[model samples]
Target: MTALHWKLVIDAADPHAQADFWARALGYTVEDNGAFIERLLAAGHAPAELTVEAHGRRAWRDLAAVRHPDDPYEEATGIGHGRRLLFQRVPEAKTAKNRLHIDVHAGPARDRAAEVARLESLGASVLRDVDEPGGRWTVMADPEGNEFCVQ
Candidate 1:
């Protein structure tokens, strides 16, 4: 048996914006993909309409991604080989709660409240605070209303 490689793909109205937000929030790196895009364009395989300038480089207009900084990636294409999140543009709006969510753990050395405040500063809104015998966590929504937790 072999393990498969995969990335978490999110639907968003603005994939580039989502990538930027997640990259900063998670201390990750935005995948460049500029060189690959350029090659595709030069080879007449991709149209210019499908690309946009991001971070001063070419990127897929409807797709963007962020990856853990320490993870392995393909240098030529700037595609992450591990721990990646891909955001793709979608026409429809999010109308329901997410079935799955991310939980950000504030390690014992870090202050949870401060972390929550920092996330709020980055366009996240606090939904509510949970204090239970199991543990305490703060539910929050991102700029696009995706719910996640800060523990």
Candidate 2:
């Protein structure tokens, strides 16, 4: 058997903004590496030029992450050690459709329409509504235009 630890990586123009949107969408929490960054700077092990102010706090200029709300994390760095998605800044914009995407299951007990509406309020736009022989779902795009489905 093999052991593996993984997190999805997404490229974005603004990693912090992407992290914020995904955190709200998935009910996740954004990782706060401020303390660890400060420690690194204080010890002269890191460059201050690699840091930025985000969400009114210090954060890595090019990277941010969001993790499942129930997952465990490091206290000092606030970096999630469990299920998470990491966003990194890139020079190029998303120029095409996403080859990989997320499917959000609001479930039968949950109001999918209301959920969609809520997501819309959180900077997601509806791409399309689907009602097919297989099942019904809505295709939506995040603030940065990454496509995801709500089912």
Candidate 3:
């Protein structure tokens, strides 16, 4: 059996902002698809309206992504082959709790509160702190209202 490669896709009102937030939060790098976009445009395979100038280069207007710094990626398309998160723009806003959420663990010897504070500074908000028998953790919401845990 072989393991499959996959990336988590998130729906957001602004994909670029979400990508920036997540990249900073996770210590990841934003994928730069400018070269591929330029090639597409030159080949007349894609319209210019689908792209916008971002980070001083071209990017998809409705999509953005972040990938772990250590992960392998394709140089041509700037697409990560492992540990990636893709954000796509949607017409509507988030209306309810997320069924699936990300859990951020404070690495060894790191302070959870400090991490939470750092995340807050990055536009995340603390929803609540939980001290359950199972474990203690902080629940937080991202800029787009996506819930995640900090432990």
Q: Each prediction's Cα RMSD?
A: 0.7, 1.2, 0.6
Return the clash pairs for model 3, or none.
none
**Candidate 1 lDDT tens digits, 1-151:** 8999999999999999889988888999999999999999999999999999999999999999999999999999999999999999999999999998889988899999999998999899999999999999999998899999999
Better of 2 and 3 by TM-score: 3
Tens digits of per-residue lDDT for model 2 on 7-67? 9999999999999999999899999899999999999999999999987788999999999
Name the runs in model 3 displaced over 4 angstroms. Answer: none
> TM-score for every candidate vs. truth?
0.98, 0.94, 0.99
* TM-score of candidate 3 to 2 decimals: 0.99
Better of 2 and 3 by lDDT: 3
lDDT of 2: 0.93
**Could you tell me which 10 consecutive residues in candidate 2 have the lowest summed lDDT?**
1-10
**lDDT (Cα, tens digit) per residue for candidate 3, span 87-119:** 999999999999999999997789999999999
Q: After superposition, how far is residue 24 of candidate 2 from its true place, in Å?
A: 1.1
